[model samples]
Target: MRTPTCGPLDLAAWLTSDSMANTTSTASEDISELIAVDEQSQDVFVSRSFPQRTGNTLRIGYGGCTTAVMIQAVCKTVQPQYQLFSFLGSFLGPTSIDHKIHCRVARTRDTRSLASRVVYAFQILENGSERVCAQASADFHVPEPALYTYSIPLPTIDGDGPEDEHHAPSARTLLSRGIEDGHITSSSANSYFTNFHLMDQYFDWRHCLTSTSTQTLLSLAPHLPTTHDSKPLTARPQIEYIRLKCRLPTPSANWAALAFYMDGGLSFLPLHLDHKSLEDAGACSTLDFALRVVETRGMDFGAWHLRERRTMAAAGGRTLSEGWVWDGEGRVVATMSQTGILRPRGEGKGRGKL
Candidate 1:
């Protein structure tokens, strides 16, 4: 739990420059500001030269990145006294790394201790055409003392690297990379994830999936779990540790970063469950997502957090996945759930290239 650098967000000062909108960009300034909402007007905000966090260079923007941006857009407009507690949204269209999304926030509810807002994310394309890529609702609240607190223990991951200030891949990445490096099987990598595309790792099977306390395994889920309990490839929750690449300069930036990481791992989870990668899918894209903040006292960008993901169910050309985020002290930082399309490779219809 690192402390965020001090200062109230001065989004206006950063907006004076037009170069802040460039899609192909980076900055020496705090990466926090780079990812913060670029306020355009009272209700509108655009990305401020935010570094694209795509797994592939395609027309479809990363749902998690867009979700992070949309959440921050509303966070910018809300009073500083309130903090985000819950968020829900749906992807109605597509977006990409080559575009900048404009988020418009509409206040739907307000009170002294609580507030609610709805956000619409529109991606401005190269030809100046804007499409509604996503829409979401966010709820924020003033701090309140907890009556009682309890959370499931932070399950120990196998030889999980020591926590660092920054620089670590998520659990999903380790699992995918393990498969690609020949731990699970020599299958092609998922086309939708940056992790699945990488061909290297420094760990063996024993380093990632087994221990004495609990036998939590990060293996592939069988296609028919209900009828295949006796099979070795049963559905089990996956665990991995992740951290931001650098420290953010403000509280608002931390929230956006949390959201960005939370929205990830869903698109490729279904494929992983069925021993398939995005390369074996026809449609694999997120349709909707939800996030609930459980605790935030010391949730900082530069600390390692565990993301546990598993498919709740998969059928009828769709899949529902759930994840839990736990801090080093076993605190529940937040909980997330997502629903998306997951068609077989030959179906050749819907969104996502795999």
Candidate 2:
């Protein structure tokens, strides 16, 4: 199919059109610089671009989340009865806001009981540098008659009964000022982060006992070096570096099944110079990012109180592999695995190869 070109203005027009609908679609225009919707045979196509530089850090607004939402949207558009079984993605490269992003979808198979598709996401840079930023393949299974049936006992929380008197905090409060802000002193916020996001979802996460301070949790995983860090430091470092290590919670039941469910939501952030670092070198630009959910479970949202996150996996002088997501649970929600012509940040891409 021919490459589609779209801009911010085009997105505005598309949003106003009656043919395009969905609250998520309406939110897309506000976050992205360009958006394109197309039809290819029985499948649909959606692409978007965002400014590369916003303030100091690379700005990737709700676009990453919107992309995931759009994939489910496409599935609903094509097959209304199908439920989202799972999703998985791998980050291939960095997406600059100065570049245009193209997303293409093609159906690989559609049968009575299952449907699968391949999605390609890439960016076209200003200097004619084109790279595949992210690639994803997904399978959506339709329920049918099976030989075996099993179910796990759902966890018990304080508000399980009719008069439990438990009230969930608003999404904004749960995300922005609470977990994302690292303010866990509030009882409601702590419960939402530790219990609601984990126990409710059937997954358990235990923080390191020594990490009782906010600084400890904030430094759980440090960002790796970007391409520009090749030079020697001219000034002495002012602050000391600290590290924290924690173990993945062991599943008491359905371990393997839960592993498969948890594996797909793992994502990582690559090291790259922030906007301030770039500006310090006398260059100002926008950075854009895209991520795909290769695998996930229905309880991901309910179990993990993920607030906000940013990730990248870059190496050498080129953008290699990366992934990012926001979870209110303060833990990794979705795992993203990427592969392409380029090698990944640390090792080769697709280490999990799920």
Candidate 3:
């Protein structure tokens, strides 16, 4: 297998294509960059003009909610004085592309060093029915001199190299290779299944695992450095070195991007380990997503960061999982958690109950 080069990644490229030529947006900016504040309603209207991409198919009014946009709107509502340190979001339902998401944010409490707010994202249907697509509660704090500081030891993973030399196959390339090599099979039943691979194109994931899986698709896991004497971790965490394809300028933007990236494919960690094909079991959909930014500053997306995700449990037709993001220097930047619904393919009608 040849090492794939990391190229520039533009999410807007997926949104703006020959197919979308007829589509126009008052806010033509990328999904990660658009948020309009409405003073009258004390709410924000987020534009979801980005067309949804599923595998090879591109369509409108499809795909999951735009988490980055939700996070951004919440931050924007909170304004600039305080910084986001923690947030939790519940994925109530899918948003409609035909309508702008109405975001209502409220500052519930504020103090000298800390503040808290709740954000509601909903859509009002033509029939005048209101659907709450998602909602989040966040805690923001003023940067204060810390009296204590400590970080968990970073996991030692193989294939450590200078940032430039740590390239891996792009998500598209890996999918193509998976299909060609008979490692991954295609299912036309769900557009979401098709778009799963396409979603990985937004970021670069270089696997740190050096072992073959029992299921044989090369499950993502963390491994100790070759020179380290510590035994390999018995608990398999989906570990990889990740970097965004496009650079987000501010800490808030990066937090939103992290929220977006964190929500991608996490619920499937157990399924990936179980080796059960989606045909046999099913695909997963995020129900709720949460993240805590333990460390706010000095983080750069240009460099690789270790992302370790592990399944907490799976039951009642749902799976719960948690993850941690550690910078290259061994500082833990953020922690995340999520729950998702797992519905088998070809069992029901209409987009697999996400």
Candidate 4:
């Protein structure tokens, strides 16, 4: 990969720009000093700024943008084949783009092959409010020397010549204009994830079922009578449930990979299935999810069908686990594990399919 222009001079210029812009914000009152320079020992630099916000709710937009920029800068310096494997962030208090924010990175380990780092993103509001908007620890694996190699075959797809093939529109396309365009040309009145989604030529995904149908079944099931219309039943009937799965394929890259085993179980029912009526009636939540990386194939982007999905276990308001596999062409490939929380939809929703 090409190196990014992020030397000491470039860093200085970036900080200067930030400092100049800060003069007009409310944070300027609280910021007694602003400074950023390279740290030779760790081969990293620190950027500090002051911010001001009214309440304790950190602005998610500014936080995400700042975090992305900070990560990109550090990665450019470290030059790791870095991928966003996992992210866990929370808003502790209100923050402003102009507030005094300090980004500090520390190298935790450096071996012959791999390196790890911890990043702390701190914010100080004008009202003497301090918060840590994001903190992350990441590990980078060194690239191994290539030797003998083997790979699974790519998946098969019907021929509709590449030019005539009908490609499904991705959520990115449906929501934002291409990155080249600076405006939000698409409708913003959509689901949060759909509005700010990630799309890569590196993977292919397909939906096996509609969200509406799944929601309907989940909503109506609890209301169904345990016994016949008029009969008094001794035992309550068991609820029937189905697992929905999506198939994924690896895109052609040196390393074909996929983020598998996302802990959707936590959010699966409350976020997607549970309804207000059921919550009010004191119905128990369902815990059911399982995913496994089945096979590995050669690095390539090809069509892969979701074979089947079944609930492996469900008990005590907690789903066991879910697994996902990426097929490189025809052979099974990479995998990942993830955990999520169910919450009301924020800004992006119902805009487009993932």
CA lDDT, every model vs. true structure: 0.62, 0.33, 0.58, 0.32
Q: TM-score for each prediction?
A: 0.74, 0.38, 0.73, 0.39
Model 2, runs deviating above 4 Å: 1-44, 48-77, 127-130, 145-217, 220-354
Q: What TM-score does candidate 3 get on C-alpha atoms?
A: 0.73
How many steric overlaps does candidate 4 have?
Answer: 35
How far out, in Å, is residue 165 in model 2? 14
For candidate 1, what is the TM-score? 0.74
**Candidates ranked, most accurate by TM-score first:** 1, 3, 4, 2
Q: Rank the candidates by lDDT, best first.
A: 1, 3, 2, 4
Best candidate per lDDT, number? 1
1-354, model 2: which lDDT tens digit per residue?
332232222323322345433233222222112222334344544344242221223222223432442353245333744544444555444444443445666667788877776666555544454455555556666655667543322222223221212222222232334345554335544433442232223223322111111122222212323222443221101111111111222111111122222322112112122212121222211132223332233323323332112223333333323333324333343333332232333443331121
lDDT of 3 by residue, 180-244 (tens): 65555543213333445434545666655332221133432112122212433225556667887
User: Which scores higher on lDDT, 1 or 4?
Assistant: 1
Clash number for each model: 4, 37, 2, 35
Model 3, which residues run further than 4 Å from truth? 1-31, 34-41, 51-65, 162-168, 172-194, 197-201, 211-234, 343-354
Query: Of models 1 and 2, which has the larger TM-score?
Result: 1
Model 2 lDDT on a 0 to 1 scale: 0.33
